[model samples]
Target chain A: MLNTLFSGDFPRSRWLTGLLLLIAVALLLAPFLFPGSRPLDTAAKVCIFIVLVASYDLLLGYTGVVSFAHTVFFGMGAYGAAIALAKVGPGWGALLTGGALGVLSAMVLALLIALFSLRVRAIFFAMVTLAVASAFAILVSQLFHITGGEDGLSYSLPRELTPAFRLVQDKVFDVRIDGRLLTYYLVLTACAGLFLGLLRLVNSPFGRVLQAIRENEFRAEALGYRTVLYRTLASCIAAGVAALAGVMMAVWARYTGPETTLSMDIMVNILLMVVIGGMGTLYGAVVGATLFVLAQNYLQTLMAGLSSAVSGVPVLPNLFAPDRWLLWLGVLFILSVYFFPTGLVGRLRGTGSGR
Target chain B: MSGSFESLLARLRGGDGARRSGLLLIVALMLLALAGVGSLPTWITLTLAGLAMGMMVFIMASGLTLVFGLMDVLNFGHGAFISLGAFVGVSVMAALGPWMESASLAVNLAAVLAGAIIGMVVTGLFGYVFERLVVMPVYGNHLKQILITMGGLIVVEQLIYVVWGPDAIPIPRPETLKGALTFGDVVLEKYRLLAVAVGLVIFATMTAVLTRTKIGLLVRAGVENSEMVESLGYPVTRLFIAVFIAGSALAGLGGVMWGLYEEVITAHMGMSVMVMVFIVVIIGGLGSVEGCFLGALLVGLMNNYVAYLAPKMALGSSILLMVVILMWRPEGLLPVAKGR
Candidate 1:
């Protein structure tokens, strides 16, 4: 029965299942093979970004809502978790509490925005969200007493649950373990759970309604479906998932600030990952996150090498470093929109061989 | 007087009268209140500053509005054009400093002209290339448009950084316009005054071209119904190029003025000012030139007032204005009429 449920006549499902299993195995073996703080750290960060991009795709690709303020929820979650750990305590209970608070806040905010701007569509929704996010950034930044102003807030965490679990030095087999490996496993577990949840949701009746609304909201409304309600629910869920990623980020980074919480860069990064990988496809999120992280790392390395080779030329190697990355990204985005609207994964699926 | 005011209001609200008088009356009252408060600046100074700032905002917002209204392209790299214009203009002026000093007024005017030319040519070329290569592909797809434009923005910004470096560069202000003008205790910067004058000239020229020229007519027609215009065999693609060029040039011109106003140019200016320009365009009804003018003034004043109130709030005033606008008029103050 399980095989029949999993296996469909379409070859795409078989390929997808196979690819997913391969990825799962690779994720499980990553820590043991890499055995380093940096590699594990990168892997963990990639997982967090994957979750973030997937959440963004949930709304943009599936629901057709271009939410500009998605970062606000993510930021809130980071701060929520940070505050909880700092003011309250760092434990599983605290993490759950922080996630719950972030989700509730996001849901309330989504409800208010949706209720007010439900009549407006497309670009109008984008603009309003942009405004709200900007306002939120300013509000948080200005409240220095709480938000730590531009300097940002900092807090120390209690000792790990088991000091022996550290990825860098071990006593049993003389293998080293440290926080990076721990973070990697934690993030990977979260991502896999969320992925399963999202897959189930997308295949359910509720997901069909979302697709119908995305295709034509007016027609869906005429059919007696409450489009706004469904959209709001999807948006809230996306926000919650994004918040989960944010919480993980805060825990991993061990530092939170306005820049980390609500920068436009985060929004751009999430958007790029989702679009580049493929929209409306779960695997697209994974692909986008992987590609974006790898490409950015490679580009920075290349730039750094060039800067070092040319003596006396001060080349700033930062996230906001002046480079052709943005230009290439822009060109790629335009090309994707024009030639491959379904994204790289979608195109591959169309070929009938990838499946 | 009260009876006449009420009648005039009724007529304007009913769309029977032009509402020009009502607008003037409101402007007059605002000016009076600004002066009478003693807390604010003199009426003339406030109005002059507001109008000048408004004019620049209008220039920036017009291009943004046009692209959004006509093609539904978000044009995320709109700021790149502005930064490009400023950098190019300032560089030209710096290069020609000797000639400008010897022939002061002539040199300054020439620099302004040169800046406008460079800004228009370079940015127009960019617009054309971008439209054909980047924008053309993502015509109706919002996600692709957003991604590609954003990517373009990052690339352009990085390129600027590579060329100009990270530090802000100070452009030499015209020697003749270095001092401030004092009007009975109210002091105004001469460059700002010059900016106001130049902005007005550009506004007038744009208005004339858009309203009077044949190309302008086609642009209007294109905006209203792009498919119909294409079907008529009017070289719709060429028309799009013209519109893109003109819009980009306008942005470049605004960038020149911005460089002069700020006295320093940085690569991040494009992204920083983008949100404000977006707000102005949305408020101005997306496609209406006249609406752009009105929207710019409203945003400019609101921005200044917000700055005035910032000491108390800690954050800048624009954020507050954004929230208020989002809450009250999410479609913007003047939503474009559906179906063009």
Candidate 2:
């Protein structure tokens, strides 16, 4: 089946493959090049977001379901991991347990939601998910004693859990052992593995069915496909992957809060990444995440500088600053919708497709 | 007719009647439970709050319903327009505060008019752009519409944050509309009443326009069947633009009312109120103005009352209502007329 699928002279050329390999290698090594503390952490965090955005694309871009509450899965993972680590002690065991619990929680929630709302297409589905996620956030926040309310939960976990894995040692360079650096490698590896797995899934017959549903659900149903089942499964997988990213986040941040789990802002960010990068394209998720995070970081820095420069004056700083980054993001979204509706990747493909 | 009445009476006297009575009894018991368990005061407060909040909801829903009715587009970014209105209204009020204070009521009215005009213009421009750029391409494509509009929402939200800053800003209510009014034991905020009044006025005016005016007729016709309206020589594209602008303006109006009622405006208002607004739209039935009104009122009441009864369960009530409605009437309480 796989051979038949790739029988028509593989679409990608040797040069393209080589270039992709180089980019992947560069990305893997990029964190090590960053000397500073914050920049390296930021780079690692961006990878987590890239994983998140990609997982979101699995359902949204590929399966054609616009979920407004995808972050709930991620949050579950984070909280689950945090609880596991706090209660069971930090080790590989806790990490794996946290991941399993997160995925299980998402699966159960997705199943419940899917049973009812999966049959409803488009806006109804979006609204239902939004309601569910919002309710979850509210419930979590209100249960102040357990979830810690708005302030969130924090704990201490060591970086070098397995000392034998330290392959490099250079004390002359004043390289301090940082947990964040180790966390970054682990996340990178996980994201890469997941990305490859998603690639395989998208290439499978199951994926074709999903795409068929996206193109025309009625037609797919007419052809005897169970559209709801496929969609539900896709949502489950997407949620599980998102949970994986969430676990990484909890380990990295050492804190979990209501805001982390049930935030519409995060939902918006993920949506923006998918749309801006390009729907139906795997690399777009990473591209969009990179652009969004870097732009936001730089915008804030510039805004802060401008604000300080005009300290004596009462005028608001530049509109494109970090504080005002949401405005820019909003504008970008509108512009993308209006002018470049297909998004960056779509726009690029348009030239080749001669559309 | 006598035989029919007798049969009806017989049925009422039988097991069917018993079942009906049982159902009614259950409903009555639930209501009593709601009232007896200290839920009445909470319900009243929530109802009032919902009513207060419903005014804005109605405004937003009016526009949303019309757009959905006329064009089968589920505008995900509708909240952005509401946010735009709030930001613009607050900024204008803040800017013109001094000028309005020294001037007469007419000047105050003028400031308000100016604020509304600004909101309408800005939000209309946004609508026009959205229709032409975002909506025009994905006319029948729901998935594409969802993606593009979701993107549009983010862009609009970020733009507001950039222009207005991240923090919430206060938009001063007029001096005459600043405080709460005491009626017996009830203390109602004056601005909320004003908001409701404004909402009613707009609702009435919109109703009139749809029923009486030429454009209104076209809109109504379009809602029923755009192709038929187009075949009759009306410019349906222009109608779409007009509807988009009008809908956006309603959202803006809602935002302004919200700013006044809450006494604070933030970039996040669009997102914060999004779920409730969606609930209103969904419950009211997509593309029905009357449905929007009823939905908003129901939601407002439920929202306020539920909070009062179980302060911790504020979010649960809306979801529960939605679930029940969806299960019973999936097409909503007032589904848009079909095959028009």
Candidate 3:
């Protein structure tokens, strides 16, 4: 299995494979290496988002459908799991039931949308999805009985994943790897596995047909490919994967909310991740998610420091105000889209990088 | 020059017949209002409220459709113009505090108009710069347009924070504009009536200009075929830029109206209202102004009616309507004759 994974042009080239392996190893050992709660949490966030963005990439990068409803499926997965646990209490059975339900619901919604909207103009489809996604978020928030309204749903996670449990009494590398460490590893491994699975899926003939459809719908249709069915299938798969990402997020946080999951903000963040990481490249999600999560967490602090550093002269020192961090991020996002359409992963991989 | 301008303005105000979709929408709204509302006074109240809401929405959304029709530019940053216009209006009101405090309706109205004019001028200038810097390079590519313009919106939103602080500013309605006029307990807001009137004026002007005048001819022609228009020796790019400026101005004007309607201004106000604006645009058909007007009315009426009936579902009303409309007519209610 390992030889086939390594040998069958599975991950672009040996250099990329080495880099991906290194990143995976680092993520697996993040808790021990970082030895801090904040860093571990951030890394975990990066992991969850990697799964989310990679799932998004399947639709956006592979199938070429710009769906605003991606976050709705994500939110559904989180809420589904959270609500399930809240009702039945925490156990493997509850988790499995919730995960299955979430995946099932996401696929259902995706199919409905694909069937209804797949034949429309691309922009029209995007607009319809935006409207649907926004309505879904609003509905979730308003259904206070089920979704806990704006406060969102929180419930007990599986005991092994909770922070109360400790696997070791002593510290390794001056870090306490508690049950939270176990959770972090779970997220890391799950994300890595999902990423690799996506890699294999995208490299398959199905993905090639989707790409051909994206490049030229008319030509793809002329070739006797039922583009709509292929797109719908791709959307359903993406929705399921995104829901799994949502399950991971809910498990990691032990909570789910409209603000955190269902909002357009998350949808926009996912889009940014894919675009900046390089759309079309499965590995791009990993890099984009990491880059975004880290930047979002610390960019403001860095800006504050820079502003204070320039306080003596006070010449545009407010350029890096924490509140204005988005301004800079927006500028950077635009510049990247204009200059680095291939993204960091694509650049590193070099010419004609699977665009 | 002044006589010509007046004639042009007159042509704009001339009544034009509604298209098939527009007429159908009006009939549906009337029928639904009658069916759901029951009482005459309640129906009137709801209709007036919906009318006013629809008008405010139309002012904001008209710019988006015009721009899209003219340029095929998906300007996600359009919200920035709206918010800026609102903030500018607030500042104008603040500066002309004495006038705003006046009980004289004429004085108060003039002050509000002054603020609107200032907002429009400033937003138009900003729109020019925004177009040049953010939208020019990424023309013709929808994907890039969405990404870049979204980035532009973020930058502008943050800039608003830097300028206005991260607090929601209270927008005080002018003294004369406050309160209501009641006819046998059928209370109608003074500002809302004014908003409806303003909306009509704008709509008439837009219709007149689009249908009757030389520039209107160019715009309509350009909307149908910009390449052909360009081939006809007219600078279509220049026409597109002018439309952008006008659209931004309208957004600013609408923002001022919405700010007064809400009695508040925040950096994210434009973003919040954008949901409604985008919905209205989609429901109206991507490039049709008349469609936007009809769509806004439907959405506004549905929102008010549903809020009265089931408040929880009120938020989702417009979206539900759009879904239904799209189910029936996949393109939109009143799709333009442009090649999709």
Q: Which candidate model has the greater DockQ, 2 or 3?
A: 3
Q: At residue B59, what lDDT does model 3 achieve?
A: 95
User: Can you tell me which runs of candidate 3 are displaced by over 4 Å?
Assistant: A1-19, A166-177, A312-317, A351-355, B1-18
User: Can you tell me which runs of candidate 2 are displaced by over 4 Å?
Assistant: A1-19, A30-36, A87-94, A162-182, A258-262, A296-317, A325-355, B1-46, B95-118, B211-214
Interface RMSD (Å) of candidate 3: 1.9
Give the C-alpha lDDT of model 3. 0.84
- Candidate 2's DockQ: 0.47
TM-score of 2: 0.84
| Whole-model lDDT per candidate | 0.71, 0.75, 0.84
Q: Is 1 or 3 the stronger prediction by lDDT?
A: 3
Q: Which CAPRI category fits model 2?
A: acceptable
Tens digit per residue, CA lDDT, model 2, B307-333: 655677767887887777677657566
Candidates sorted by TM-score, best first: 3, 1, 2
| Highest-DockQ candidate | 3
Ranking of all candidate structures by their lDDT, best first: 3, 2, 1
Residue-level lDDT of model 3, residues B197-290, one tens digit each, is 9999999999999989999999988887888889889999999999999999999999999999999999888987888888889888888898
